[model samples]
Target: MGIKRLRYWLSSLTGQVIMVALFALVLIQLVGIQIYRMEREATLGLVNSRFTLQRLVSVTRLLNQSPPALHDEILRASRSETLHLRLETSQPLPDERSARFEHIVRSKLDYPEPLAIHISAEHNPRRVHRPPWMHPHHRPPHHRHPPRPDIRLQGGIELADGRWLNFTSLSDREVPGWSAKAVLSFILLAALLTGLMIWLLQRTTRPLKELAQQAERLGRGDKAEPIAETGPREIRDTLTAFNRMQNRLDRFVSDRTRMLAAISHDLRTPITTLQLRCEFLPDGEDKQKIQQGLKRMEQMLNATLQFAREDGLSEPIRNLDLPSLLQSLCDDLQDNGHDVTLCEPAAVIYRGRPSALRRALQNLLDNGVKYGGKVQVRLATTPEQVQIQIRDFGPGIPEAQQEEVFKPFTRLDSARNLEDGSIGLGLAIARTLIHQHGGTLLLGNHPQGGLLVRITLPH
Candidate 1:
């Protein structure tokens, strides 16, 4: 049961659309995270020998040589790596001296040749003397390792020269939270748009649902009202079509009913005249046969009129005691020399059209007495529903033919009496009446070798 319900939900168009939207949202978020991480990784760079430590030493030494008054300015400028100053000595060096200087440079920077310097000591007479051990290879006591940069802003990467360079930066200083304000705003917008779409979809589809319900009701012999016209152009047109069809169907039924009623009405007068005419005939076999034929025709005309009238009855409902009604029917039959008994617990009140219900019950009782010698009627009620059963003691109708016997113009061979038999509309009319009261009439075999007709009514 649970799995069946789940399958039905999954099959619905609304559920499928929602599932697709959620999948797309999750996919977009995942892609965003991957791109963000890739951008972060691209911004971090590795160190190289050409960007040697000697360049940093030269720049720092130059900054230190500046005048005391300009010291703060130089330091501040150096922090942003904007400074670009040249270092010039007082005299030219000999070839041997330059070569020795290059070797010392290699030993100090721990790399070969190329380097870049940024500050100049032009405004100061003396450069800050570096201790003999203060070479590029000689790491400073305060610098345990190269400084890491501000990750949230622009991050800095360390060069082999011991200089740090700022890399890619984010435009915003602070990242926004996807919390109450943001979420609420998104939800409000989505809700407004979704509501509008839902309304439009329902407008287009509601008539279709109503039309389906109408078809079902009609199939069950119910005269449901036609669908109303309201919605989009397509839906409105469809509803209009359905209303036209219903109107045509109603007219057809009306015309047929009127024709049947007219034919039966016209024939009744002649049948009455013929019946009277036969009564005065000589007392012989030919007269008796003619009388029987006229009687049968009258019975058919009467049954047709009754059926036509039944279709026009307004189903005005009322509350009545079902047990008492069944007992009354059984008692009446018994008093008329029929073997009918009533089995009831107590008064069981139910809501239904009383007159129609009585007619249905009467038809069943009549059938019981006509076929079976003994009739047993029983009533039982539960909190939720009520059931009345009429059992007859005789050869029951065949199981295969039980459903067939309830159709209009149907009669069992055994029930047909040459002397006096009905036109075979009783069961059909009973079924129609029972259905109007929102109940069911079922024919089944009785356990005690007879037929049982059960009527069930819901509370």
Candidate 2:
């Protein structure tokens, strides 16, 4: 698929719904986890800070009560892995960012200058080399470990004798990491929800698909069975309306055909009565004119009745080889001494009313031979439809009357009269039959002097 089409599919209802749901789910999970992590870090930091303050106060009190001679040893004993303590005469500058923390610590300890509080990552211990004057067996350099990037808190507190006691400690972190179990749960939940959404979409759109199929059949004049009203309320209502419309179309066609047939049948009796009245008159030009008029009326009535019967035709559709049908039709004309030529087409299997389609082709072929002399027939298939071209070697129809000939009871030559065996329904009936099969029958004048009848049947 191309990018544009894929993007269009993603913009559909199911795609949007699934995308929104998944986005919301991920957003909620990430936000919730982040909030919990922040709360956990805040609680841990508070407790650790209070505990470190107490330890600092204890060490300071012990140093104050002890003698000056024991100060160095006391400070050395207080030092440990987590806490590094040192004494300096000059006080280090206090960190501006930790002003509130400094005030709290100074108030708790009392009798202190401004305290220094700052946060940073701890650094590795410095490496040292022995001096050249030292003995050959010199003391080994201090052992060093890889530096850690964990948070380290440091502070400076001034004692009563104006000595600064600086201390460093690593921040205690107890926040748990996101686990594999949580990840698996999220994946499984998203999958389940996506599957449920797809199922629901299929159920909702299935009825709509059926409605579209039936609509196509209806356009082709096929009496499709009514679809079962299913799906959501809107879909059910649409199907119901479509079914009612189909029923009404069927009724309308049937009623019109029946009324036409009835009128034509009733007119035949009057035409017969007129024929009897003309026969009783004396043999003269007027008597002959009356008889001829009655005969024309009878011919017109028969043609009308036949046209009505075809209008109400309810033939069953069947699968047939279209090329074979055309070949047989041409062969029949040839056997009957008609000048018919056929260009054999490739095999094409099509589904339609075979009888109706045959009659339509026959009409076109008959017109070409009877009115225009020799007929040339050609059938070919395109990707989308089947085309049949029929041309004759006689005076072609004029441009103005090309479309008019397709109308019922329309004659190309007014002087030809009804005796020529044409009630002008041949083109009309052929076009009607083709239309009923969702095809087209077009009339045009051939450049080489003959009428061209082109028919296209969709695959």
Candidate 3:
């Protein structure tokens, strides 16, 4: 397939819409997972920060007491609503180390400045006066303080009243490195799978569309063969069905055509024999009548055989000058003294089964001369189509009866009276052959008081 057509199929609104919807769904799912992970991380951060604060408060209280043993009773007594204190006999760090230590603890509790709490000495706490420009609505600084930096505990929480507590440690990065890699890999794999599905779906649909086009051509009576059966199961089955239909139709037409040709062929020998025997009759008025009847019978048989030829059997197409052929036919009829005239005599080359087309045209002219008392043949052409008209001057067939007259053996009363030997197969066979040639034959009443038969052929 050409790139243009393939793109057209893929971009068809239905397929494009489906693909877009699926891709959007996958994207939303990925985004949702990421959002959930971020929210979980924030929750864990709060828990870890609160736990660190409580641990510092407990160890600082323990050092202030300078206990012989870090007794559980002393730790319990120091506990308060704002802080939990722990006493231990550990030497105080040097001033520089202690100062650096405080910086790290303050950094760990890095809230916005307004939410920060100050740690102060238990006795004679350093004066903390509000700044002169502080907002009137702000409250005084609270007594409780955050944990010192040096202490480390598994987890803890500090309260405003100097109470503290601890809890087990936990990492907020719940999704591990391997898990994140796996998830990303899955998304890429899913994208690849989705692309493959789109390609396969489009490939399957293309042949089905082609098959539908072929079936339409067949319905229009143009020769169209079955497509190659290859695709998904549904498309393959549809192609198989189309092939089967073609086979059945071909067989049916072939059988009927053969039967008709056989029956018509069998009648010819008898017709010829009858003509020969009619000649042996005594030369009287009765013999003359009988000979005329035999000749008409022979004509009907010939017409039938011509109709059968429109079936499976056909001559190979070749290029021929249409104008020359028509002129020749006109000349032969004129020599026979039928008023047959050619409107246009220029050479026109066309590809066709020449013999079949010639016979069809000749039959129309014959009917014109036989009943219309005269024949006028006119030919015209345009870029897209060709038209031939044969008009007769006899009493024309009624408009309603024109259609019936085109059926085999359907002789109109007027037609029968005009030609006493009318078998009514002439127009029928003409129509069949014209249709086989991808043309149409129509009957209309001439404005000049006669029958006008028009044949239109596509270029």
Considering every candidate listed, which one attains the maximal TM-score? 2
Q: Write the per-residue lDDT of candidate 3 for residues 1-459, one digit (tens) a residue.
A: 699786875677446755776788679767877887778756755564455454564544453345535445554554432333432232232222223334445565443343323232221112223222222443335734422221112322233333332322223233634478767877687677677767776787788878877775554344666689999888799899998998888788779878878887898888889888988888999999888887887777777776665641346656877898899898999999988898865456776668778888988888888888788888888766788888999999888888998889787775546466667887887887777667799999999889999988766
Backbone steric clashes in candidate 3, count = 12
Cα misplacement distance, residue 265 of candidate 2 (Å): 2.2
lDDT of 3: 0.65
Model 1 poorest ten-residue lDDT run: 117-126
Q: Give each model a TM-score.
A: 0.59, 0.71, 0.49
Candidate 3 residue runs with Cα over 4 Å from true position: 1-202, 205-227, 269-281, 311-313, 316-396, 413-422, 437-459
- As for TM-score, the candidate ahead, 1 or 2, is 2
Model 1 alpha-carbon drift over 4 Å, by segment: 1-113, 116-226, 269-281, 317-352, 373-389, 413-419, 435-440, 455-459
Against the unseen true structure, what C-alpha lDDT does each candidate score? 0.63, 0.76, 0.65
- Per-residue lDDT for 172-261 in model 2, tens only? 343566789999999999999899988998898888879988887787777878999999999999999999998998899889888998
Cα lDDT of model 2 overall?
0.76
